[model samples]
Target: MRSALMLGSATLCAAISPAAFADDVLDNPFFKDSSTQVMARNFYLNRDFHNNGPNTQSYREEWAQGFIATFTSGFTPGTLGLGIDAIGLYGMKLDSSSDRIGTGLLPSSGRHTPGVDKAEDDYSRVAAAVKLKLSKTVLKYGEMTLNLPVYSTGDSRLLPETTEGFYLSSNEIDNLRIDVAHLTSLSTYAQSGHNAGGMTRADVYGATYNFTPALTGALYASDVEDLWKKKYAGLSWVKPIDDTQAFSADFRFYNQKSTGAERGGDIDSNSFSFKTAYSYGAHKLTLAYQAITGKGGYVFYTDGGNTNYLANYVQYAEFTREDERSWQARYDFNFAGLGVPGLNVFARYLRGDNITLANGSTGQTEWERDLEAAYTVQSGPLKDLTFRVRQATYRNSFSGDLDDVRFITQYPINL
Candidate 1:
């Protein structure tokens, strides 16, 4: 069944593309229904290691500010509409020393080896894309931010990882969407050590189907050159029981194998995860389970700052290892039901066991607990401002224990 679904999705993706232009492309308008937005993000990260390792930094801290400005122009009024989009990205280091550097807030000084022992001053970059639209299908070229199931960009730090690629998206079919892309290079958002000049190539194809108003399913396949080939599929369903009660279920799976010359070493892995949640008024509860079964562990491409769509991808531990099983229990509360609007809190605990290591050990175990509180301004001059505080404690049989804390503030401006 999964193979059939994947084949169908691949066929659909191959069949979708943008329409060709009938007249000169210059006829399209430059700005018809254009919009622009700018966001200012302030980030602070701190980590203290309980057991100090000689090669690893015991204490890491960094403070940085980021500015992200995006401008998107509407398609020109014609049968073949043309548009342009541009982005300006900049990151400034506020405070960091040589001893306390590896926090990823600023670029490191090393060129060949990616490290954060010596921090750099600041870094900035720019990107632009040309887009052509015909009916409900659009074709884009140049730098882009991808959010596909198989290969997506990570934006958890001062700057988001961007890629140079060609993308095609079509929504002409009712309740179904198709996406295809070929990315040639990637720019790590980091200014210094790691993200300097490493660019890789990858290709992806995916399709998403909306079965109903509350049910959606997706299939995706990707190949990162000679590195790995990954196949992913997922289902999400939300059901409203009453006005203030609801239930939701999310399931995801990944199958990865080495391809071509196998540059990143051999990998043969399969991973699956599921999460179910129930919401009642301001209270919510969630339960999740995830496992990996293969000779190799679950791995994805990231330059130290990236995210995967797995169920157990927490702040500290991803819970992904060779022959591993994990479970999580979580709870959330919204202050609006308690007469305090715009406030929310959530906490979760995860445990993993039966981790198979390269040394042939199979009884390793680990756990992590995370708590976060966040609030957004309801109204007044500070409307739309958001503040968040996150804390996590992680312990494992293989590595040192860590206590992590993060404070973040974000404000958006439209012009």
Candidate 2:
């Protein structure tokens, strides 16, 4: 979607509905129910490498400020409604230097390439989408953010990744929803262009069904042109034992195989993960086990939006490798029960083993530990302001050792 097209369409609508002829479309539900929001985010990232060498930078650190604004217009009144959505992103460097630059908070001079050692001072990007609705189905074309099990966009950085394509969603079935999309290009969080790895076409389809209010299932598949085909299946169930106690189980599986000329190489892997959680009044405990088997490790478009949904894909490590296995244990607590509302904390640990190194070395292992605390303002002009801090320690002979820390602050404004 283009802003110029949106403006032209508005003018056309106004001209067609001369006040004497009919009500102005601009005054109709379309513009009346529209909404706009902006988010201000301050982020600082520091990762200290345990071992740094000639080819590797000792540590990557960056501080940045970002603003994300979104505008969503309500559909016009008609059998086939029309609407538009737009997103604007701006990032400014607060503190960054050539020696400490690969932190993802700012674009690297080489576009996220390590050891390039230069970061842009500031960047801005904008995108929009035009949408149509008929009955319970909606179709949109232009830039968008997607989150399906098979193909998802990453948002763990200064700006979210976006895709240029056509997306469709149908909710004709009572308890089911269907989504399909055909995308041609992608823009990474650190890049402003949509030319990612010569992406010719990526088609995806997904369906979700809610058997009951407490149980749901989903199936999704995606095929990246000349790369690979991936399929995902998931199930979730929750049981409430009492007013403040509950148990939940989640299962996820992925099967991937190379196709066409296999531009991404001959990948043949099956990954599965299972997670269970128990929640009490103000405490929650979670455990998960994930494994990968077949020819190689899990593969994704690293430069575009490669956020693997596997359970072991943590802040610093993805415990995914040929014939690898990993498990996690986590605990969370809410301070509200102790008279401190809007505060929470969590700690997690994950370990992986049964992996082969680059030289075919066997019995390799890796582990990571993470702790985080977050709080949101409860009242006053600072209401809804949030602050979060995370610390992590990762160790792996194959990937080296590191201590990572992140501090983030965010505030949202509605207009």
Candidate 3:
């Protein structure tokens, strides 16, 4: 029965594609009304640390390969057009050891690996969605990625994080976009299966307004049942100081409180961050400051997945601390104007002080320094292939000392 259903869905998708692209065919019977495209990506990552602590690993390394396939069909004929989309994700481990088991780069089950007993093996997931479009608004349901500022879906690891939910978005108003979503279930990187009975119900709402070509503002609220409720707002502005120079500024504020089962007790926090950047030709410099107030500092939500990529402000880096103050300085350069079209480099330093840990320790300080370089193929058969190397060193009065190096190569193809 399941096989039959899957086959029927695939057949329907094929039948709808031609009709979806009919409008684009200029009196050509062979022209289809719909369009379909697929994107495939492979990512490799390696991490090694110099020292280990009770809470940290001394040396860890991993290499993972992943493949993602997506297919989309255009809406059928009608005022309320409907379409179907499917996505398939698979990941395989290339290297790792028991000492690096919790790196979140692969899926591990209990004490045994799925395909390999001693060695971690492979995992895969398949998801499908139904989409509807009415005027300038679109509604999507099923497995998807959440990308709101307050509740962003992470994509930091082998596979992008996904949620079982429904999302509605509208761009009916010029320069403004509105988004709202509800998530009911989740699956994490540590597990290959879905949990429909978990404590993972959330409601998210937000709107972004582009006041001008160079200025924008956003506001959002999220109610995460059994976890936390948060309200976030931010604004960003950019202006050209001169023909060859530009300046940008950003501000963000978050207010959060615990809720439901996860809230053993009432806890509240308020956090704010501000950043300014200046660019001259191929070089850019940025400075940022952040502060935390209230009893709690910040709240975090994770699906326990390998995909840890989140908002820039939420990253711990070297300056993240509870009720602590921090600052960062960064520099970046593009080598395109220097004749290396697809090369870029960046370095940043962050420092924080006055940390409050689990123990009643204050006046604790920490810092981090990070460097990264990346390049991509601009043309030829391997065009769009990218390579990156990142190195970071962290030292904290409470968290201990750590150093890490990572290298990744990505090949992205769109069909």
Candidate 4:
């Protein structure tokens, strides 16, 4: 959410960390740089709906535990170095019942009932990718996680989503990067199979340039077979105002057009947002303005795990509708600046209006408020362990209202 383009982000199918090797494999270039890691996650979610549709559940609550194991091998020593990466994910349901389900932490479907067809007790999946590196460029085939603006796989749950196909990343040019991918399949965390969301072919391309030491720009585009075509451009600038203060500004633009079969209905929209932030000492303030104009809202691949890099993409609402406009104000405090090394707190509020309904009505509005605090163990047997709590409330003039809270704990182990 901070930047329109998430460059250099790790492809974690729940991923992370250094190349800790075994004694025997230290001599080989491939094994010397190979490493393994496992992340243990505990998640609890509770969402209360104040206004619900008829015959629908009022709330959803669930607790679950997850383990993500990842392994990466260094490239072999040659002109075209070859390597492989693998990931294993497992999730176990800890608490849930007929009345409380649909937490997204565990795979579930069908009506809200305590039956075999509802929620499973445990689920596990594994995938691997093969890679070849030539100079400063790498090409990968098979399953992997993506974090591009045009096709970012979601990692907001107990596990991360993944895609299958050919991907290329090139940093051959100075301060510039080129990314190209042909995605053929997708796997969501809330589903069991690798292609649980169905198989669709998509072509995505992106380029990023670092204009200066403190300025960067990016452009990305995608074509989703029969759904739509999207293009995005972004600029980010940051300046330092002494040793303890800084300022930053970010701008993002997106254009979409329905193509082929037009599975998303008639769509022609342009969306843009600008956000600015100032940080002095331990306090930081950010304000953003965003608007969408067209016949319909901004259209993107939700099922393929694509992300909206707009500033107003909040916790419960996107604030993106026909002719809709939204603004956000946020404050953040790092406890480290206040003599607490591993603590942080954040609060933000957003309000959106000028919405145009399908029936041609306008002026409806919506708002979302969010608060979160996080703590990490700085020094202890469980060093680097993190615990976080988040709360959000959303209200709309023409839709359901919700109060949502989440508790999360994570521990990473290297082996």
Candidate 5:
């Protein structure tokens, strides 16, 4: 990994053409401004037991460290402005044993060692992107981190996920936005490697309309070849009840079907989610309900053929299950209003039952509880730095035993 980083750094330096170094070429100097920013992060995670099914136990503990660096340059002077962005990432195993390996936070290959030992040593990746802007729209190509509902990029591990693709976004209309994109390849958040054999081509389009100051709606459609095609529509509304209190509501519906090489026979699925929240003083309370109605279950893209789609959309409090129903209750408190800025706490509980497993099993029930605390530096050189800790416990009557604990800290700098 160190060698790869050195090689990539050298390539970047060599790729900068002398013609691109000229100064005072643009009429608007701000448009051609260039800057570089660096961000570093470290993560540690450990789990005492892993239960695949009822009475099953796989116990192990592990820890890892990761670092990420990024550079961005403004477009050169011209009618058609152009810019470039680069990202480099690396991860190393700080401590881990063979028996408790495979945390998905780092790359693990080959067979696991018997008894107890250490896992792999390290992994890394480097990516770059180019962009062009005109009027109120921008076109970008290369590695990207997508954040849309139907085709969001994953960032649950050492590094943010990246996709090799092209994307376009326009905000020409008043209070309206449009997004269109095409992805050709994908790399996991761990930056361990890229998924070359999996579904590589994907197309997505979405539009958002802000009807009023407090209300908005969006519609999106995505065609992911060799995977599932999905359509999503949602609405959000907020109403302030008082100076410091407000009520918010969100509703979303999803329709999905398989296509091309990813056609898992024939699948038809529909999912709906609704959330309502109320705020009072420094406390906020939220309740959500989600249900899936279809021939099978909710569909998601997973590189290792894992059926459980428990990613971003599925929160710690609730998960979208196949032919199942779930609900969650959550409470959060902000300390900023209480004279302690940049501190917050949250807790949630989720329950799901009546799940239909893929192997023709039925009558399954599961529940999970999550607790989290986070804080950020308010003023100083470390301002905007954030620290977070979370713990979760999951139990199911039929799905086996599951328990986990995670801790993370991050620093974000804007250039």
Candidate 6:
């Protein structure tokens, strides 16, 4: 990892051509005018255990404040345009203690060791990226956040994960998009302190196409050093029955195999999921099914935090264990349909069974239920002020029962 980081840093220095600074500094569009935005978020989380005794932490709770600022420059005025992007992230612990930790809102004092109880007060980081654009194609290098099918940084917490790498994207052809990248390292949102060389390395290639206004498809492949090679393909489609109703369908599949000296041991796995939804006016309903079959669970790069792309990736569990099968039913309502323009409600339930663990136990079962309600200020002085509440419950054959809740508020301003 250290060697890879060094090579990445050296490559970035050599990629920026001297032509970028040829134009007059004041006249270049990249520097003359730029756009900026700032976002402030307040978050609180609580989780209570029903069976884990007092010897362990009986409950987990925390409160934190987060701020994110971003700046993006316009391109230079020439056949070859040059630009830059910058990001600043900060997280402050508003309320926490040694006895009540493990919420991931603040970093722990010790590393990954278990049964430790200490949290940091705050953390902050700054990053910048250089970009070049020419004839509908763009190249970028340095630190940035990515949210693709194979690799997505977690942003549900206080701060988002950012990676150091080089990226290439092209949209020169109609209805087609191409992307490729080499990611060396990343700092996760859960890090206690910043370190650029602690993450695994990977190479990714992907393509997407739009067959029609109602249908889209994608294919992507990635290789993680000392880990596994992964391939993913998916499709989504929507049809309008009338002005007041619509139907949509989504399907996704993943295939993985051990690579490079069998890093995670011999691995062969396949996972697939499907979801269908129907909407009428402000009401929506959905149904989904997902399953995994192989000698081991579905594989992903775990050194840096990663999120699954499956439809069954719910609030508590992904239901991607070896030989597991799961299904979901969900409902959502928009209060605007009933005259309240800023309120909404959602609920979902999921169940999984047939989990095969290394211990040779089979037929294990688990289930979870989630509910949420939210509102935003639609007009007046606090136009964009938002508030949300979430509650979830989980029960499994081995881990006991759990309940959790979260409260969140966000405000943003453009500068």
Lowest-sum lDDT 10-residue window in model 1: 17-26
Root-mean-square deviation (CA) per prediction: 13.1, 7.1, 7.9, 11.3, 8.9, 10.6
**Residue by residue across 254-352, what tens digits does model 5's lDDT show?**
888877775544568888888899999899999988888886667664422221222214323336667888888899999999899999999988888
Off by over 4 Å in 1: 1-30, 111-117, 192-199, 303-307
Sort order, TM-score high to low: 4, 2, 1, 6, 5, 3
Local accuracy of candidate 2 as per-residue lDDT tens digits, 363-387: 8899999999999999999899999
TM per model?
0.89, 0.91, 0.85, 0.92, 0.86, 0.89
User: Model 4 segments beyond 4 Å from truth?
Assistant: 1-24, 109-117, 301-303
- List clashing residue pairs in candidate 4: 12-15
Report the Cα lDDT for residue 309, model 6. 80
Mind giving the per-residue lDDT tens digits that candidate 1 earns over 241-302? Answer: 99999999999999989878877567899999999999999999999999999868787654
Cα-based lDDT at residue 130, candidate 1: 97
Instruction: State residue 307's C-alpha deviation in candidate 2, in Å.
Output: 4.2
Candidate 3 local Cα displacement, residue 278, angstroms: 0.6
Quantify all predictions' global Cα lDDT against the true fold.
Answer: 0.84, 0.87, 0.72, 0.87, 0.74, 0.83
Question: For model 2, where is the 10-residue window of minimal lDDT?
Answer: 301-310
Determine which window of 10 residues in candidate 5 has minimal summed lDDT: 303-312
lDDT, candidate 6, 1-415, per-residue tens: 9999999987876675444445467566886777888888888998888887556667788899998898999898889999999999899999987777888777877652335657678888888889999989989998888766776667777877888788888999999989998888877765634444254687888988999999999999888777778888999999999998999999999888877776666678999999999999999999999999997878553534564788888776789888999999999999998999999999999999999877889999989999999999899877888899999998889665889889999888777
Model 4 lowest lDDT segment of ten = 12-21
The local distance difference test score of model 5 is 0.74
Stretches of candidate 5 above 4 Å error?
1-35, 50-57, 111-118, 263-266, 303-318, 413-415
